[model samples]
Target: MRLNQFISHHSKYSRREADRLIEEGRVNIEKNKADFNTVLEVGQRVFIDGKYLKAQNQDLYTVIVYHKPKGEIVSKKDDRDRRIVYDTLGAKYAHFISVGRLDFASEGLLLLTDSKNVARQLMQSDLEREYILKIKGSVTKEMIEAMEKGLSLQNATLGAHHKSKIKAMDFAPFLKYEVTKEGTNFSRLKVSITEGKNRELRRFFAYFKREVVDLRRVRYGWIELNALPVGKIRFLNKTEYKLLHQFLSKNDKNFYVSKKYI
Candidate 1:
């Protein structure tokens, strides 16, 4: 790795900062000041201020549950004149990414992490990432049933063979279809899918001719929003993170417990 690049990767500072550090003779390789373009061979011990970089793996993991409020744009950078999710995160984490996006018009259960490796794992695992979204419209039992039948949306199609990614999943069968309900204008649904297509949740409603006045994801993979307030963030518990990774390595027999696989 190039000295400049290695410095940039080790810290959040940009390449310019790295150049300044190297030029100022602050970085060293084996006790010698590192040149700006020093090529570090494999197994080389590089140091910054004499402190060996303790390589931190995604093995040091974090899973956060954020109740994404409506109108918040899900992006690291927003072109439109709107509030970005970073406004809330910059103060919380030294680094993080919105695991996935929730539409500006929708809210609920968004994941944030600084570990790119784990994020990649969570995003690509085929047997994971089912989210439950609560929505509202002129929907009926038939429409819900149709969701179980399948629908075509903007870019891809959803095949219905399993229960809704949206359903009553508060562990109460009596509230099987109602727990996700937020208001007369909204019906909470625990729908599960192994993949995420853009606007897929809302588009799923369109298949039933139902208009969504509001939508929010109450769950993702294995983490749940539970009673989390809108627009706030919270770190995932040990059990939640452990279960999510474990689910990824196993079969999805307990799909209801977590849309994630184990």
Candidate 2:
């Protein structure tokens, strides 16, 4: 990994902070001052301020589930000065990396981990995400067709962030969907999809001229929100950890879990 990423993954420093440390000549790799672009190899020894930054025990890591509430950005710091997930997570979890993101207007089960590798794995995996949505207007056949057959839009920015440069997007077929409440003014439905593209659900509904009034994720892979209250966090239970261990073992040949996690 790059020096900045190595520091960020193993220490409390952010990638930007790691770069600053390198610039200040406080970081060294094998007794030589490291640059921002330095890439570390296996068994490399890193020192910061003459103190060794021990390599992580790949078998040991922690994962937490946070019922992220609406109105909070999933970032370390926001230029807009809005509330961020760390504000609620507190300093104790300041270094944890979020697996994926629940947009500012969306809420529900969010995974965070102290291991950057774990976070990257989960985020990039094609795990099913289940959501309950309350949308404007009834579910139409057109929407159902798109959900079932998949969709591709060249101007897929309707429900995306204003600063997003992603104008085109290809959507995979939804895993499943069920309409629980149908009405002209609003409708409620539960849907599952494997991809976690930017504002994907919102963009899909927007294509049908429907607005998602409320969106909440209830499940991701084997993990569920269950009865977790809004804005609270809990460590992954033993069962979840076991499942995670199985998944990691399958995906990464080098990955190992401590017996405690199994």
TM-scores of the candidates are 0.62, 0.93
lDDT of 2 by residue, 1-262 (tens): 8999888778989889999999999999888988977899988999999999987776789999999999999998999999999999999999789998989999999999988879888998999999999999999999999999999999998888899898999999999999999998999999999977899999989989999889999999999999999999999999999999988889888887679866
Error of 2 at 93 (Å): 0.6
Each prediction's number of clashing residue pairs:
15, 0
* Leading candidate by TM-score: 2
Give the top-scoring candidate (lDDT). Answer: 2
Per-residue lDDT for 32-132 in model 1, tens only?
Answer: 77886699887777777777754444345566778888888887567766898778766666467567677778777788876555566677665344455
lDDT of model number 2 = 0.92
Worst 10 residues of 1 by lDDT: 167-176
State the number of backbone clashes in model 1.
15
